[model samples]
Target: MTFFDEMKTTFKDIPRPEGEISTLEFLEASESLVKLFDLFGSSAFSVVQNDMKGNINKVSTKFLSDPINCNTLQKLILLEIKENGKKVATQGLLWLCRGLQFTANAMRKCIDNKDWELSKCFEKSYSETLTKYHSMLIRPVFKLAMKACPYRKDLFVKLGDDLNKVNEQLEDWVAGLEEIVDVIMKFFESGNYGKGL
Candidate 1:
């Protein structure tokens, strides 16, 4: 299927949550997000570790050594895109992963802030960016990933299991991030962020 078709297929499964959020909801969301972030970090590390035969470490090193303001994760996405000339699915997924990592880091910082109101504002921006990236990039790439690696009863089942775990972890992270964003929006709407602590 074409990228557009794949994106449509992907979106069909995602529920579009609507309506306003409250401060209690936002706090709960943030807590869940923090837990997801921790889980995502571990999952990401596992992927890197499993790449013993691959060049993820080299790519990571190059990214860290680069003078750009962007982090190593961002550089990894760029490297993947550049290297995966014909692997559109891999390229797309890498970019989406980069966006996830970026959002996770941003949320971590926001959650650390002493000023709840400012943190909520920052979270709002991060959530908006994440939503755009997920819809425009992640869905199609994910389709590509599944297509590239068709399920088979082969000896390399372990590899497939690892990939599945990574994918599952990513989905969980996205869900947690969305929850936090919903709460942040509610906090702003209720003017709770502006109130004295």
Candidate 2:
């Protein structure tokens, strides 16, 4: 399998017990993940944007939902990188980061400025859901992004920070961040932690 596949397997299988993953090993793995996600992000956004240039609501509900169709776009990104050059790959990935930052900022604005309870509730729900399901997904992505976007400290930090914000919002969001290797630790019962992973 390719590195991304290796990553998927690593992501799916829980991290080892007790011992910490070597910081260097983690950093290298993080680089690959960032590069790949960047690639995935650029292509996916481009395709979706072009396909729905005039219909953004449709785009969100259709192409960009969670557990979305990014899988295929991800593969395309990896394949292109494998076949092309690193420069091309990096460019694509950078674009992806920009897109993510834009969306995240917009989401933040919407969260802060709500005219209705429903809007606030929707923001709360989305944040909680992603915070619940996506800690595993977002951490490595952030680590990778940090490596990739060294100059853009704000974006990297903000994105990384987001992985933790939801649980804080819910209080349950750490009442989370307390799991074994899991980013958000699920509270099962007293003294027993259930991992969101």
Candidate 3:
């Protein structure tokens, strides 16, 4: 299928078959999915001015607002669009982001509800998506950002060190969520997701 076709195929609102993993790999994979989702979802909190909300709020009042599809995510994503992607139409990217954001929401729901049973299917699909995204999206964007962005070596200069700081903070927050997913996945893969299971 063409890239556009693949993109269209990815973001359907189909509900995944949710259930616990009978294998250890299932648990680890589940965690990987959640981690990837958080990493991607975090863009909303980092780039968008008003969007923020994650479990990190369990501690402080930092990212309690919803940042889904806010300005920041749109800006960088737009800035990083490729030539082939350029002709894909604006709605294409919007759909892509919405689809990704929707997946992120599902991962977050699993985390919030502590639904280990359904997490198994989520783990498998999520890991695959992350791998595909890294190859097709994230890696390409970084390469383009470093070489293609007009700022080049000086991109961070005008943005200030605070940009990196914010990015780091976002990473740290998402890392925690990832750790939980990883542990959960590992547990089920090992047949022990719960403290004693």
Candidate 4:
């Protein structure tokens, strides 16, 4: 089976009604997406994986603390704002969305440009999505990871035997991820939750 098929929670399954993303499912799907780094078969990707994991844990902890009030991601951040104004989970969710956007953009590039290498796709996506947020010191590390991407054909082969099927699944998965990131970003923009983040 493909990695997407094996995921416990695919982005396509996550609920986002009225632009409110469900917290538990999004966290679960984020966790599953982090595993995609493993498929790259390069230690350099550990940096990306760890960063995503840390943010996911932050949000998940808050959700577990009060699932009733934090049913939707919007509610989670709103309640956090109301209770403490600390915005720990809010910041974490923001970073997590950025990471997800980076991944989705990279995958979309790969799917859209048949001639492009994995390294090129990842580097281009990183430049557009996460470069500004990363510190100067952190940028080189991520750059190295992008350069360490496995050969496009090799990675695609590992994804599944049928390239067409893999591309189709990846396109749908990336589309779902992009939609989630867009919704969360718009919410953040509306509330200025990302003001100091």
Number of the predicted model whose TM-score against the real structure is largest: 4
Ranking by TM-score: 4, 1, 2, 3
Candidate 2 steric clashes: 1
**1 against 3, candidate with superior TM-score:** 1
Q: What range of 10 consecutive residues in model 2 has the weakest lDDT sum? A: 172-181
lDDT of each: 0.35, 0.31, 0.30, 0.92
Q: Which residue pairs does candidate 2 place in steric collision?
A: 167-173
Off by over 4 Å in 1: 1-36, 39-85, 88-97, 104-113, 117-125, 136-197
Writing each residue's lDDT as its tens digit, candidate 4 over 1-197 gives 78788888888889876768999999989999998899899999999999999999989999999999999999998999889768889999999999999999999999899999999999999999999999999999999999999999889888888777888899889998988899899999998988887
lDDT of 2 at 23: 22
The better-scoring model by lDDT among 1 and 4 is 4
The estimated TM-scores of all candidates read 0.23, 0.23, 0.22, 0.97
Candidate structures ordered by lDDT, highest first:
4, 1, 2, 3
TM-score of 3: 0.22
RMSD of 4: 1.0
lDDT of 3 by residue, 28-106 (tens): 2222333332323234223211211222121112111222322222222332233333322223323233233434443
Residues 25-110, model 2: lDDT tens digits: 22233333334334333343333233222222322222233222222223223343455544232233323333333333333443
Model 4, C-alpha of 141: deviation from truth (Å): 0.9
Please estimate how well model 1 matches the true structure, expressed as its whole-model Cα lDDT.
0.35
Candidate 1 worst ten-residue window by lDDT: 3-12
